[model samples]
Target chain A: MSRIILYTRFNRFWHWTQALLILLLAVTGFEVRGTFRIFGYLRAVNLHHGLSLALMTLVLFAAFWHLTTGEWRQYLPTRVFLKEMAAFYLTGIFRGAPHPVRKERTAKLNPLQRLAYLGFKVLIIPVQFTTGALYFFYPNLNAHAWPAGFLWGVSTLHVLGAFGLLAFLVGHVYLTTTGHTPLANLKAMLVGYEEDA
Target chain B: MTNMTSPSGPIRPPRPGRFIQALAGLMVLFLPVLATQPPPGPAHGAYGRVRAERNRDVTADHTRFKVLQGPFKDGDGSAVTRACLTCHVKAADQVMATRHWNWRPAATDRKGYGKSTHLVNNFCISTLGGNQEACSRCHAGYGMTDRTFDFTKAENVDCLVCHDTTGDYEKVKGGYPNPAVPLAEIAQKVGRTSNQTCGVCHFFGGGADATKHGDLDDTLLKAPRSLDVHLSRDGAAMSCTDCHGARSHEVAGPDYGAPADRREQPRFAGEAVSRMACTACHTATPHASFVLNRHYRKVACQTCHIPAYARGGLASNLSWTWSTAGRLKGGRPYEDKDANGLVTYNTIHGDMVWAKNVKPEYVFYDGSMDFTLLTDPLPATRPVVLNPLHGSYADPDARIWPFKRHDGDQPFDPVQNRLVAPWTAGPKGSGAYWGDYDWDTAIRLGMEKAGLPYSGKFGFVKTSMWWPITHMVAPKEQALACGECHSRQGRLARVKGFYLPGRDRAPGLDFLGWGLVLLTFCATLVHGASRVLASRSRRNP
Candidate 1:
């Protein structure tokens, strides 16, 4: 049997809440883009805005939790076995080769996963938040004489962030479905647990 | 180790599953309801009855404006009334005569008048297939869609459509009609509701479904007007009269040259007195930088401010239409079967002539071949030059010119001779080459040759002797100031570029802005694709 250890209450809470918020945001965001109008545009916009705000707040709380608890080390990328992990995903997966890296209590992600998650956490999310916040508060900035190309540049960055988020969502959905059972990864997110390998 | 290890492990506390489950149950039972429930009604134990009291309050407030009648009633069963019309009864009459009121179902006989025939039948006339709740909100008055209420006697327009102060118009009557009334009040007595007044009807949701205009949704509405040119940010913010100026009881009347008896006068006399309505606000100086720095005096505000009128069709998009006259000497390819016994061979030779025939009687100067050569310029046959060069000529020197009969001293005396100059003989066999000039090109060339600084290219050549004669002799300074006739507020401004959204950078800013947006959107697609590929490889590995 796999041993259970202290996961810390806030860590589990942040992980589950952030995951749910991202999923909700993705659904509404796509709807707003006119991909499929499941909920009406107004409703979708409301949900998207609400979830985005919630996610932003969760990120703030999670950052505090990570810093105070020193759990931010989990996302620190490593060069060890990075190339092997990349090779395994690119070609070895087709041949049913074993995974090059393993997840443990101390290090929960492979080197490649760590790097990708690090980019998402440190770069992509910040860009999206900054751009979106600026867009939201544009009316308030009316007093300021914006630079000649400022609005265009900021809007472009916002759209780019939107596309990046969309890609991440598609990959996430696909990976979740690719688990041992069709719903195994989905259940792990919901319950905050996974079966031992 | 053997001594320390007992059969049973160290004593431990029982798992707190029950306690946690009880806590979760308590949260589920109590916390969410507490978090989500709206605040309770006022301290009155008869809170359920408060809604009735609120209706009475609204009805009492509305009564101050106008009397109520018909099946319409407030929630408290008081008769519904015309609240807005009470204050703006005079203005309402003027509004009804304008295009805004005419935006309804066309009379069956009005078929040839373009899209005016395509009526939006989406309200009380739903049997006509135009009755949708969404369309009625903008087109018809308020409360038309209330299934529980009958608005049969209600006017198509409501007071709150323009005076949307409180979302519920009844509760907030005193919020309007304060003391800051202007000296010449263009609009009726209303408060500081400018753009907000217009936005009540123009904005997304409420009653208008944006899809009717186009496939536009709420997200599209959120975009700035600069991005979507169809939208007017001002239209969404200001009252109709803020720009339209003065509620005239009369319609725009007929075209400028309509018969006098049939002509309609301006609704408000004051509106007619001042050019301040649309033109004064949209001054000749639109670009602050250009006006200050370039000393570019030639460019008028209307030069770039072209009005885009709504096209006439069901899919009525906005478009601009410009008309130019071209002279063709062949007389529209007509075969003149009847000619004099001389058998004048019809040689189709026509140069784009801009010269008008000078009557013999009005010859301030005799320039025509016959008049100049004749030893004694015959007073009866004396043709004064009507070629624009003759500034003001005597009636005797002018010929029996039909064009001049209606103009100047000839003064179009219908009783004396119905025939006008130029066409005095009615399409005669005059060998004189006469036709319409390409006025746009001719005027440009004339301006340029006269030492006028214009920005546009002149396509035609000014070969007429009249060009130099008129420039040197006529009021040169007055004629050269084409800005007097072509300025933003001039009659030509109305004729040429009918709609100008205040002078900005360029006339085609809308197109340029859209192009940039499209280019950036394409770049985003490429970037997204690359990232997706990179992510897929990482995930697969």
Candidate 2:
């Protein structure tokens, strides 16, 4: 077995911080909506707003870092080996099969991981930010031409986006456990190194 | 011209002879066309003077009429009415029969069973009190001495109180709220009434400005458009009569109780449009959004539109306590006022609480109200609802409505179980509480006058009344957002007997929804784990 640098220092920082912020946002957001009441509604809303700002800032910085380091292309989805990787998890793994694709310093994510992450980066996360921002600055929104239910609709959409985020989070957590050893991928993310499976 | 003598007396000349001189000059100049020109229709000149009346259909100038040109021309209200009714025979009969003159209104529906006459209210209990003159300060007539006041008397009907076009007619406080305006002047200048005409009494009713109705006040006279768009002079400039349409002297509207359901009825000419509903102007589906249109079915327009009442900075009477009335400071009848200058205590009436910008409590109301009458049996334990707005969630006529809750502490006969309206305003011999400060004597006289039994012993009980809040509508921007109501503990949280989304939890339904999501998540984790375990088993085998 050989160890390689699978994650950069900045990548580790962004990943950990983004995860922390997302988790905080979800907790405070649910509290504001009275799903659970750890913090009161007013404070939960205030903290939710602050955490959203921090997460948005991190997103901007990570986007800049990815573009500058040419690491933005790492999440580009490919059809090649995508079907095979899914099959390995569902069936091939049961037959004492080897992993379908190998991990590397330049290309750490399998095709399935790449596609899922790509959707998170492009659609899910961006949508969350848009809806969050709308809620945070809802008083400033010019709803003159909007229908009477316009604000209600926007709030409903924001709640839906939160549920979407939770689903993605569950899938992400589960995929982390799919590594050869459960802590193998977690450690790689923490210290920026991984062993070939 | 020779001095003319009338049947009643010697004729008096017109007060403004300048007008006659001008008319003479015009007549001489227009003499050439007098033979060929078509007759002119009636036209009003400055200060309501008749500028022209060429049409024969218009009545002859009253200044030239012999009955009105007599020695008794500038007489009191009764004398003037007698002369005018000679030509307007039907007017007195119409005016005398109305609630304005009678101080009593007939019930419009089965549930609408009370009027100003019999309403057992927290404001002052009932108008059936021996003190009718004190209450009649808001009455439309001149003198209403007691229950024995004649209604059939034609001379008692004051016409100029409403018909006065000149703003000179004003009701000043005395024995009652008689305007004491000049009869002849008002009669000569009579026409349609203005907002000022209705406002003089209604706005200042219940002893003070804005104390009775939360919706109306002196603020409406010069209110900005934000406060009242309809009454705003800069906006629609609509008078009270515009909405409260009148025909045959009876005003169209409900006064005793709010309606639960009313379809828009068309107002034909010369008929009273009695359905006083906001939907009369704004249709049910006023909003463009389909979702908002759906809300129209269950939620009232006022519930969304009027977020706050008494927004005009004039606070409404929120509560009154008559049990503490006899408290005096320095041996005189004591009076104390709150920060809003509302009378918090009067040695005569007790304590009162006033509030402005109050957020209305919500309820499912159909428009009718059930009042605890004076004769109704008092409950021993529970606080009485003096006036409870009647409605139900399951009722199709019902909609979620907002109301101003006015509460009070008033006296009731413990043994008789009847609410007592003590003689509160009268002379020393009349057993008035204000006069002699004797509760036993006042209660006896009051209960006797009302023809009800009253125990000598009285006890104060807590009561509450609901006044439907349907005014001071905020702008669209100030309306409550959906999150206000569609949440777990929304504004409608207190509302029972209904299923509301966002706030309601259907355990089985919610479990099913989340079960699908949890199932997908669990399946992914289980599938991955099984695959790994199976692959290891295969290697071992």
Evaluated with TM-score, which candidate comes out highest? Answer: 2
Off by over 4 Å in 1: A5-13, A30-41, A91-98, A173-187, B1-541
- Kindly list the per-residue Cα lDDT of model 2 for residues B1-541, writing each as its tens digit: 2222333422232223543454344334323322322343222122112212322355556545556653443325567667778888999999876778765564443443443354577777776667776776655555565667677888666666677777776553222323355655556766667677787777765667888778778888887767776666544556676567787888755556667456556767645575456677666676544345556566887787777778888888888888888887887888899776877888887888888877788988888777777777877654688776777755667788888878878888888886887777787667788888888888888878767777689988898888777766554556776657757877888887654545655445435435655876998778777976786777787
Q: Give every candidate's TM-score on chain A.
A: 0.80, 0.95
Candidate 2 regions exceeding 4 Å error are A1-97, A100-165, A172-197, B1-76, B107-117, B172-180, B267-272, B487-490, B502-541
Scored against the native two-chain complex, candidate 1 gets a DockQ of 0.03
Chain A only: give the TM-score of model 2: 0.95
Candidate 2 lands at a TM-score of: 0.65
Model 1 Cα lDDT, one tens digit per residue, B1-541? 1222333533222223543563344234323222332443322323225434644565234323323322233321112214445554565555554443443212342222211122111111111111222234453243333222233333444444454444333211211221232211212233333334544443322123221222222322333332222223311222234333433532231111111112123456444422222224434333333221121122222122212111111121111011112233455522222233221112221211111111111112222221111111212221222223221122122111111111111111122221111111002232111122332333333223223333343221111111111100111111122232223343233222111111111334434444554555564455445545655777886
Q: Show pairs that collide, candidate 2.
A: A94-B535, B258-B367, B259-B367, B260-B366, B260-B367
Window of ten residues with lowest summed lDDT in model 2 chain B: B43-52
Q: What is the DockQ of each candidate?
A: 0.03, 0.08
Fnat for the candidates in order:
0.00, 0.18
Residue-pair clashes per prediction, in order, are 38, 5
lDDT of 1 by residue, A73-170 (tens): 98898899989987875655545465676556667667876787888898878998897677555534541245534544564565556556655655
Residue B496 alpha-carbon offset, candidate 1, angstroms: 21
